[model samples]
Structures are given as structure tokens and as C-alpha cells.
Target: MPAPSILSPRDGSNIDPRSLLSSIGEVVYSWDIHSDGLQWGPNAGDVLGRIPEAALNRGLAFAGLVEPGSGRSRYDAIVSSGGHDHGDGVVYRTRYAADLAGRKMWIEDAGRWFAGADGRPATARGVLRLERQVRDGELGAAGNDVCDRTALIERLEQTLGEHLPAERIIVVLIAAIDELTRLNDDFGHEATDEIITEVQDRLRSVMRRRDHLIRYSSNRFAILLTGCPQNQVEMAARRFSKAVGQTAIETGRGIALVSLRIGAAVAPEFSTQAGALIAGAENALAGAKAGASDTAVIARRRQGRETRADEPSLDVQAVAALNERRVRLALQPIVDAGTRQVAFQEALLRVGHGMDGPFFATAELIPLLERRGLVRLFDHRVLELATEFLAADPRLTLSINVSPRSLIDPEWLDAFLGCTRAAPGMSERLIVEVTETATIADPARMAGILKQIKDRGARIAIDDFGAGHTSLRHLRAFPIDILKLDGAFTQNLRRSTDDRFYVRTLIELARHLAVDTVAEWVDDELQATMLCDWGVTYLQGHLVGRAELPQRGDASALLHATG
Candidate 1:
């Protein structure tokens, strides 16, 4: 207000005394110099944590506040410089400890000197800011928001400077304020405020004196642990997780437990820059919250070479090589329980290195293809191979397992139909088997897709029918021509009377719906006889035949066994 201070250099001015002051001080500080003992604004008192009158009373003199050894020399240099005309400007830094609210705090004073018209050195005014906070063992009650942020920053810088010189630091923030939301909804705003206040108190108790903790959002709090290594960050995260898990706060009505999902990102791993470090940590936290697990999710910048070890490895090149007409087909006979005559044969897809090696079954190959999103490709190939296999044996009916994903894809459907068209009577002989779990997830969609396949003269069968939560509701909702009961339900029929009863009920239900039923995992002749007695249309398991590639001569053996 007093002639608007102009110690700051003009724009593009060659002189920069501020840079020198910044470099010399432990913390950043700046001042405006003018032609007076100290041309300072009233706000300078606020920066120095003192009243303007009291600060002015102690002005321009080396007091007991400054260290005796260095303080005297600095004062002598300033007085002798009389009027420093190095023309850039006068800048100096002095360290001191000031009594702040009955506690001593280290401060750095940075100021510039200006000359008066009399050619005499005049005012040297600037900021005397707290740079380091010394904490006595007194633990203040929480919810105070009274802690000095600048002092906290200073302490964090000092502590971290000794441990590690991090290029960047990231702090993960995880919090649950569901209790606050529920409180606000039930009670008035007053109760909600109290809950939030309590949450702040709880958070403060867990944090260190140097850590920067802030209300990141209304429901979330953030802690910035400067120079924290990735491992230490993880350890801290786990401790916080355990603490949160153990805490229960009373909200008048009842006690509410808080939950948290933690995510972490390390500096230089995610980013070297401080701002980017914060952002990456936030992203990792989001991922943790999205995942189903309760444990903290730790993430780092994904290196170019990083790969998930848990995911099944697929050799794309090897799979691609086999994509060309290099697949094989096998048929397991589904016999009519009453007649013991071959009713149909379920065609199984197989992959082999060559004619001599062991063949990979449809069960094994299908999962691999699905993981690679190549199920449609494998499905189409199986359909083509089945069509060719069936064409040679015109009287035999063939069932092929189709992955749910493949059946849902419109492109795969068209490709499948095209392959069927190439082999005459292929659609009439084909049966499509889909898993119970896949069907349950989207029953309406599965029904519609299966209807399309049925319209082309192909039969539909539900595989692993009793394996999941498949109830009569599924049967009534979707039209399945065949139900293949899971082995688990039928395997121990003799051991458990309850198992026998459930199997009988399932068989009776299938018969009422006019849906043919097949029993899988019929390990022994005893299981097979029991299943046949229950009126199962077909039976398949170890007793019948293991899945194998079909050869020209195998047809005679299959026919002989069925006959």
C-alpha cells in the first residue's frame, strides 16, 4: 500500500538476485528490496509468525534469535557493503530459530537490499519463513488441522534427503467414507460433520509428524510420504490396511467399520516427475478399488517387457501353424440306453504335432483358444473337420462342442454356416454342445444363438448341466434338445443315497421336458447300469471309451461295441 513495492526485477531484466537467494537457502524464500530500512508489507508479519509492531521493534538488528557464530559476520558484511552496487541487487540468507506458539522452529530469512537517492544502502526486507519444525514428544489431540504445512514439508525434506534422493515420489490414497454417507442420509448434517471430524482424528493418529496428510476429497484422505521406496510404500500400505480393517467407529446408532482398497505407484517406475508420480499412484489406486480382492493392489509403470506369469502362455506362432487343415477329429459313441445301439457319436476336436504324437483333446485345446480370443477360429476349424469326418460316414450322427463365445459372435456364425454348406448333409448330422455355466450367464442370448444353429438342422445340447446353478428354471427358460448331466452329480451314485435321489430327479425332469439326457463320468459298469436304469438316453465315461482321434478302421470296432 506504501508506494507498491518494486524489488522484483523488471520482466526480461538481466539481473536475478532472487535466483541467488533461492540457491543459498535450505528452503525457497524471496524478498522485495526498496530504499528504506525494510519496506515490508503488513503481511510480512504473518509470514514471520509475529505482529507487525513487534517485528518492527526488533528490526534490522542481530538478536539472540540468530546463531552467535554466523549471525555476527552476516550483520557486519551487510553494514560494510554500505550500498552494494554490483548492480544486480543485494541478496543474503541467515538462519535462525524463532519461538512459534511456545515451540522453537528453524527459519531461513532471504532478502534483497536496495539503494536510496543518497547513495546509501537502504531497506533489506523479505520473508522469514519456518523451514524445519522440531517436534517435542507431546502428541496433540487429533482433528486440530493446526499443524503447519510448511514445517511438515521441511521435516519431510530433511528426513527423506538423508534416506534416499528420489527422482520422484508417489503416495497412494485409500479411504472409505461409506459410514459418513450413511450417517448423512439418516441423521442431519451435524451428525455427518461429527463423523468426518472423527475420521480426520483417526487418520492423524496413524500418520507420522513429517507426513503430509490432507483430505483429498470429502470421503478420501491422502498421505504423501516423501522419498518412500516401493518396498517401504508397500509395507506402509499394508500397515494402514490392517489398521483400517481393525478400526470401528461409533455413529450414534451402531458401530460402523471402514474398508479400504489400496493402490501404489513408485517414482521413476511410473514417472520421475512429482506431478506424474501423484497421477500414477492415483491410477493404481483406482485399479485396486475395481478389483474384487481386499488386499492392497500394487502397480508400477509396466515395463515394455513385463508379462503376467499367472496367465497361461500361448505360442501364437505354433497355434497359427496348426490353423491350416492340421486338426483331427474323434467320435465317441452315444448309445441308446434301452437298445444299447449307437444313437449318435459326439465328435471331439484334437490337436497333434503329427500322426504319431499324443493328441490334445477338445477339453484341453478349447480353454487355450478361449484365453487367446481364438475360440472362433478353433470353432470354425472344428466345424469344418467334423463336417468332413461326418460326410465320409453319412449314416453316423456327429456332435461337436462349440465355445459360447464363438456361438455369440455373428462373424463366427456366418463362417460356421459357410463351412457346413461345403459338406452335404453336414448340418443334419451336427450337434452343438455348450457348457452350463456359459449358458446361465446369458440364457436369453444363448437361447437365441442356439435357435439359429437349430434352424440350420443342427441339434443343441447343454454340457455339464448339473455342474453349476442349473435349476429347472434354466430348463423352462431355454429350449435344450439334450442335457448332459455332470459327472460329479452321477459319479458316487452308490456311495451316497442322496446322490442317487438327485440323479433320479434330474432324469425324471429331463424325460418330462422331452429332452434327451446323457450321463458323463460313468466310470464303472455299476454306474453305467444305474444310469441306464434311470432312463438316461446315452452314457459316456471311462467304461465306454476314452476320447481318441478317429481312424478308418476304428469305425468297425465302434459299431461292433454298440451292436
Candidate 2:
């Protein structure tokens, strides 16, 4: 069925666009940039604070109440406007501080800013949504206490930082309705939506005040338990399972009992990376579903793996390695599954001379380097090495993972941009893979920086796609070219049905967005074939090839192999 036209309803009667939008729970507004006046829809008052009607109507009044340094203001949007786009106006999605009845919150504005006769932004119109409230109402999912995938990533980062490794570990639980499709087939769409909402409420009831419950998928919910011990994860999963599965949910139509399948993985011990951590939980979830009797299953214990004591002068040594040219690029081959040919080689960071030499993996000192603001040097060195390879072999298409810290570093961005600008077609041959786990201060700024790279023809891939905060919305917002499916899914794909379903879902999502997808950790022909059948565009793993050093002149230098 076609959507109702904006000009008139299906009955051919003229309809006010703002009224139509507000009737469906939207707060629409028209702002005159020069006069600082706003014409708001009826629902505007329902979303904003207890301010007087005049204050709410005046654009400056709303601006004054916006959280200071919120970064995205109407004025900023005007200043940063990309002029005019063929007279269609530029669509902008910005988050700003909103005063909501004596409380402060971020509100998301999705609208278009039009250029005036002089080509400066003159008028704007958009929909306003409470950032938190939109996570549900806009997405049409769970409510209040339930967060989205992005918030889950952020909370995980925060929780991981607050709790020391020596203290209790964090537990990530992935719970799904055993067969939600059956419910959809039994009950109608509206009824099923209510059932899922009730299921979320039931799950939230069993969770502690400090824990977080996020809607992971259509039927899956990701629960984050911070400072939870390794031994306590299973108990918590079982408790969650009983809370949802044992009780019957009263939907608008009828009562329905739901069984929750839960899989859990511990943090840092499982993996410090958010994408990897969530992937582990997902792997366990697949395992739980496969096991006939187990409603909840904790991933096999990777726990109790001791972290080596921090070397007192390792930072200094790593710096010395960087300066002395000990740091080298280890190019790993990512192969195309169908042809089994090397599609591109990923440039990995390695610090050492040769085999049996004093070797240092990039991970060991990255946290320290980032904390001390020394990662810029490492990024520069890696880029230097990768660029050298690119210059040497024009035939090579290479990928390099960059830290979020380096993304914000002016010197590094300049150097990277320079490398791409050095020669024609250089950026086209290079793929910048961003580590999803790293914290990016301003994603918009990062997007702008990426746009600079992309405008020069550089490709961008989201490394460990599932583990990070890059959602479908982000995929659109950022100039992303590839979605690298988190390795954890492929690692369990051959044996886990849930992983198979998820891999297909991700591949389909990428396809829908017209973005290519790459599946990592393809350990065998079986996995490769499965991925190929599922429409995965690229595959990378030990099954294809392992990391190797670039071929240099005989006895010229050392072979540096890295992750």
C-alpha cells in the first residue's frame, strides 16, 4: 500500500502536515532563523518543559535553555550548512540539550535547513524527540528502562572503566524469545508488539537498578550486569530466564507464556573490545538454543586468564621501538571467498625485529599509549609503514585499523589525509578500518573527517561491526563502505543456529543499505560456503590466509607478524 500523501489524505481532503504528524506523536516545528521565532505543532507542548508559551515560541529562548556546549545548535547548523543542494535544502540530524520541566536532556532533531535567497540558511523545519524516548517510540520497540544498542555499548565502556580488573567482572547476557515468529504468526502485529513490550517489562523487573537492559534485536534483549563475578553469571541468567519464561504475559488480545533463551559472556576475560564482548555473548546464546534442555547457557570459561604484570618501562621501550623503526606493518591477507584470492591485506601493527626477538603486540601498550596521549605517534608510524607499502606496490589494496584517539588527533588526521592526497588513486586503494571499541569524542567530527577521506575515494569499514556502537543509523550517518561482521559470530557459525540466523540478518541488513559485508574468522570451507550462500560479500580468516610480512629485498629487514 502506498503511504498517505502529504498534500491530502487518502480521502482526497487537504490535511495539515503538522497535524497529521502530531496525531501520530511527533513534535513538528517551523523556525525562522532570522527573527528567532518558532511555529510549533500542538504536540510540542507535550514534549517540552513547563516554560511559558512565549519562551517556547521564541527560538532564542529555546537556544538559551539548550545545554551549554552541546555542540549542535541551530546557529552551528547554519554556519556549517553545505550551502544549498540543488535547492532541496540540506537534511540534518542533530542532538541538542533540551530543558524538560526543570530537567535537562538531549533531544534529537531530524529536519531540513533551507537556504535563503542569499544562499544562507533562512528557515528550518523538523521533528523533535526526546533522545531516550525516541529509542523506543521512534524505533517502535521497548520502553523507558530499555535502551538501544548504542547506549548498551556506551554503558559497557563506562562500566568496564569503573570496575577494576582485580574486582568483579562484567557479565553481558543476550536473551531472546525462543520462537517469537510463532507468536507473530499466532497473534497479529499489534498484539505481538504488545507481547514483546510486556516481555521487556518482565525482563526489566528481574534486573537490578544498576544493571541495564537493551533491546538487542526484534526479539533479543542485551542485559548488562556490571561488577558481576564469573560465578554469578549463570545464576543471573537463570534468574532472568525464570522471570520471563515462568510468568505468563497478558497481551491486549490474550495471555501468552514466553520462554527466554539466554547466553552470557564475561568481560575483559572474554574480550575487552565491545564488539568482541557482545559477539561472545551472542555465541553463547547460539549455544544455549542448541542445547535441548538449557534455557540459559554461559559461554565456556575463558575466565581466570591472568593479565601479565605491567612492565615498568614498557612504554618507554615501545616509544623507542617506534623511533628506532622497530615498529613495522604486518600485512594480513583477507581473501574473496568465491575465487579464494587475496582481496586486500590488512596492515596490522607489530613492534619487533624478527622471530625470537623482543616482540610486542600492539594491544599490550595501546591503553597506556592512548591514556598518555602517545597513540598519535603510533598511528603516524603505522600510516608511514602502510603508505610505504602502498607506494611500493600500486597493485596492493590494503586496509589499516586506526584508533579513535588518532581520529581526533589533528596531526594524525593531517598526515593520513596527506598520505591519501599524495598521489592519484591512493585513497581508492586504501581502506581505513576503524576499531569500533575505541571512544570517539565527536562522531559528527569523525564523520566529517571520514568524508574528507571518502571524497578522495578512500574506503571505510566498521571493524567488529556488532561489538561497537555503529548501528544502521550510524551506517547512514557515516560514510561507511563495509560492515565487517564481528568475528565472534563466524567463529560459532558452523555449529550454532543462532549465529547462522544472525549472520544472515546482518548480511541482509547490509544488503538493504547497499553496503558490502565482510565476515571474519572464517575457519573452514564450511564456514566460507555458509557465508557465501548467505550473501556475504567478503571473507577473512585463517581459513583463507594468515598474517605475513611484506616481501622485501633479500636480507633487507625482519618479518613482523601481528594480529
Candidate 3:
């Protein structure tokens, strides 16, 4: 319209800047030497999502946009030259205008200094546009399409595989739009798509140039931040939640207030595998949605089902009740596969104010107990109850769980050994089961503890075996009397060949190690039959039998009553 807003040629030739700009990318710009002002071509405003003149006049300079250490700062380096020729072109990266939500399309600027009429440094000119080398594989010629989840995952896996061992912490955040289902039903897919696009913009605005955003699913988005510091993971998570949930979108129908549930998992802490990390983040996101509105949660190591210390409302008084001996015991039978008779019963612990009060699930109870530093005491009490239960029944064999933390506690260990030594034939009837995923970091020390328990004539069973990275060599080292295969392997044994193969391998290894194998989570007759065929010594789960408390005057109950 106005001579196409081309920069004035220095060599008395009308070299259209658009031709040169096209070669590089969008938006050609120049700095006037005489006026010390910035100017850009016609499409600059559209490319930057800003009023080109206002953006430059407000001192929102290009160099200011350059991320720190994201190449050389053009202005600083030019200033160092004292208005002289600054040699060759310089390249740098910058984001879009600050006011634009989710419009932080990173620009790759490459410009050069040119001489004025007086042969002194006057104008600088170059082209700027979205970096074509972006590794996320999201951007194309149009720069409008959202990235697919599978491609995003592949990119992430590739990035992690290349960048791991650098000791850099990366974080993956999965965010779900709150009430997306309702939005879709009420406003139709078009309105939902608009809202999603708006959300995509907001999410894009908050991330750094290096971070990535992908439309992970119908209602969820995933952002990956590389080189994130360890301390800032929580802050980053909060930012993600706030960016999406802080405001409402103006739709054609009306104002649509969008909220988000965000889950963040930092790499090498949650897991090193890409799939595992994504799964962990999704799990945390589910937890956030299940709890409060607009919540953000960090994925932690999966300890137990719905086990987390960060629940919004924790009943501390319940813990106090537990400390005051308000607890209950239940026993689940681990049966012989062929005989269908109880070979042994695992003592399960539950907590409540009294027998009539609401009892918490073990998964929920154990985490809270561990967080409150009451696990040692709780373990001690459970051990006392289990020892008493064993002492009352000559024919009964009871397997009780001992927290690995208690093994390291000298006082607890002393009390445990003393209790076992005092009872008649108590050691033979008692089996101390240690969870395989316990904090038995020091294998030699754990071996020592296992040997000590075995020395007292009590058998040692490794609980939740094959759930973690414990090697077969390490399993061989433990003085284990039994191996309780983790329930995960038994989850879909009938359909999953992988699980079946893994289970078979574990059973074979157990046999070689001279340890009896107990398959846990055998939920149905089909799975039970398969386990028996595979030569498992014991099968335990709901299908076999639910956990039952012994009746008063019965073997376990009499001992519990006396205690």
C-alpha cells in the first residue's frame, strides 16, 4: 500500500526488501540511523501478533525478546562495537508479544548492520520468523495445526534418549480441561474446538521457547520442559495450572470459564522411561481431578493405590486414635493351589477409632502413617498382635508384614526378636514378609536383617516380588523362604502373553532359588488355575477368599483377646 514498506536501499538501487525477506522468512525490519527508530514491512504486525509500530516505540526491542543464552544478544553485541561495522549477520531467538496469550511462537532473527550515507553505522536490517528447526515437529508452513500425541511422544522419547546422562532435570506436565465433557455436550464440537484453541494459546504463552506443547488427547494437553531445575518443578506445575484455569474464554454463545487439572512429573525422579513418565503424570492428573477444583499435583513414585501424602484433607485425629491402640486386624488366606486349604494367612492392618468406626483402606492408611512418622510404632503394634495371634494357634501359620524401616530401627528390632523368643513355637508359625520395593537400598544390610530374622527361626517372605528393579542375583542373595509375585503380573494373565511369560520366568527362578512362589492378586478361577499349572506354591487374592477376622475363642482371636 505504501511502497510495500520496503527499506531504503543504500546503493541507490531499489532492492525490494520483501524479496530478501521471503528468502529468510516473515517480517523484515530495519533500524533507522538518523531517527534511531525501528521499522518493519507490511506483514510484521500479523507475524508478531502485535502492532509493529507500537511494539517498537514502546521499547519492546528485538534484542529484549532474545532468551538469555539463546545465541548472541544482537543489541548488546552491536553496542559493544561502538557504532562501527559489526561484521557478519547474527542469529538469535525471541518470543512473540507478551500481551498475546499462547502466541509465544519463537522467532529466529538473523540481521546485519549496514552503513549510513555518511559512511557511519546507520541502519540494521534482517528477517525474523518462527524457527524452522524446532525439534517438536509441531510447526509447518501454516503454523496453525496442533501436534498429535503420538508424534509428541516420539519426539519426547527421542529427546530423552539423546539428552539423558547430562544430569539435567526435565519435567513432563499433563493437563486436562475441567468439565470438557459438559462443554462438548452443551456447546457442540465447534465451540469446544474454539475453547481448546484458546487453551492451547494460553498454554503456549506460559512456556519458554525450548518447552513443547502437544494436544495429547481429546481433553488433555501435554507440555514438556527440558533443563528445568529441580527446585522449580512445583513452581512450573503451578504456572501450568494457573495459565489455563485463571480466566474465561469469550465464546460466540457466552463466556466459558475453563479450568484445568495439572499433573507434573520430573524426569529421573519419577522414571526414565517416556511411557512411564507420561503414565505417572496422567495418574497424578487423575488424582488432581478426583480431589479439588483447579488442582495441580506432582507425580511421585507409585507406593500404593491412591497413596499420597498431599491429600487436601488428612484426618490427623484418626492417626492419634491409631496411636492410642484404635486398630483392627484382618487375615487373608494364602491357599495351596491343589488342596484349596489355607497354607498361611497374611495379617492385614486397618485403622479406626473403634471396631464400629470407619476403617481406612490399607493403601490409604499406610501412606498417612508413613508421612506422620507413625509407621515404626504402627509396625510394632501390628507385630505384637501378629505374635499373639500366632502364639494362640498350634496349627495356624501367620504371615505378618514388617516395614523395612523397622528393620533398621534397633529398638523395634530388639522388641521384635524378644517377642518371638518369648513365645513357644511362635517363630515356626510366624512368617515375616518384607515388601520387595521397600527402602532396602543397601542390599547387604537388608541381607543382614533377613539373616537375623531367619536366625530367630522365623521364615522371611519377600512381598510384592517382581514389582521393581530387584535383580535375580539380589533375590538369590536374600535368605528368602517365599516369593510373593506382584499382583501386576496377575492383572490380565489370561489375555496378556507378556505377563504370562514373565510369571513363568519368575516361577522358574523361584524354584531354582529354593523359594516357594506365591502368586498374589489371583482374582478369578481361570487365573488361579493358570497359576497352579505354572507350579505356584500358593495363590492369594479375593477369588480364593476375602480377608476374615477370627471369631472370639477361635485360634487367632483368643490370642488377640489375651493381648
Each prediction's whole-model lDDT (CA): 0.55, 0.65, 0.64
Superposition error at 284 for model 1 (Å): 43
- Measured against the true structure, the TM-scores of the candidates, in listed sequence, are 0.43, 0.45, 0.46
lDDT of 2: 0.65
Q: For candidate 2, what is the TM-score?
A: 0.45
Worst 10 residues of 2 by lDDT: 554-563
Give one digit per residue, the lDDT tens place, for model 2 in 1-563: 21222222232222232333333334556677757778765556555647766668887666655543332355443333333432324544445555566766656454566554344556666556554432223332223444434566787877777774657578888887765545654664457667767777888888898888877333568888888878777788888878877768877778887888787878767777676777677767655654643555666655565646774366787788777777766666777657666778887776763332345533335556777888889889988877777777677788888888788778888898788788778778889888654423566787887888788898988886653244444567788888898664565564445456555766666666678888876767888888887778888876776655555521112212221
Model 3, 1-563: lDDT tens digits are 00121122232132222333333345546565345567655545455555344455433354444333222233422321222232212211112212222443444343444443223344555445553333344333213443444466787798788667787777888886775545654675457767877888898899999888876333467788899986787788778778877888988766788878787887888889888888788767756765653545888896776846775344475567666777666788888877777788888876764655455544344655666776888788888888777766777788888887788888788987899879856888889999775624889988988899898888999876653346655776888899887664564475445456556656766766778989876768988888888788998876777666666336555233322
Top candidate on lDDT is: 2
The runs of at least 3 residues in candidate 1 whose Cα sits more than 4 Å from the true structure, single-residue gaps closed, are: 1-313, 360-364, 421-425, 552-562
Q: Is candidate 2 or candidate 3 better by lDDT?
A: 2
* Highest-TM-score candidate: 3
- Residue 469 displacement in candidate 3 (angstroms): 2.5
Candidate 3 Cα misplacement greater than 4 A, ranges: 1-315, 552-563
Candidate 3 positional error at 190, Å = 27
lDDT per residue as tens, model 1, 1-563:
11222223232132222222233221211221221122332233344444344334444332333322211122322332222322223433334444544545655444444343223334443344455564563123222443232333354344445434645454544443433333443553444445655666666777777566654323445566665666687678766666655767676655656655555655446554444544455445545543533655666666676667764344353274365445666667777766667778777665655554344433234455687788777677777766766666667787888887888899888976777667646788788898766776788888788777777888889886643245455666776789997654565574435456556656666766679999876657887777787778888765676545556434434545554
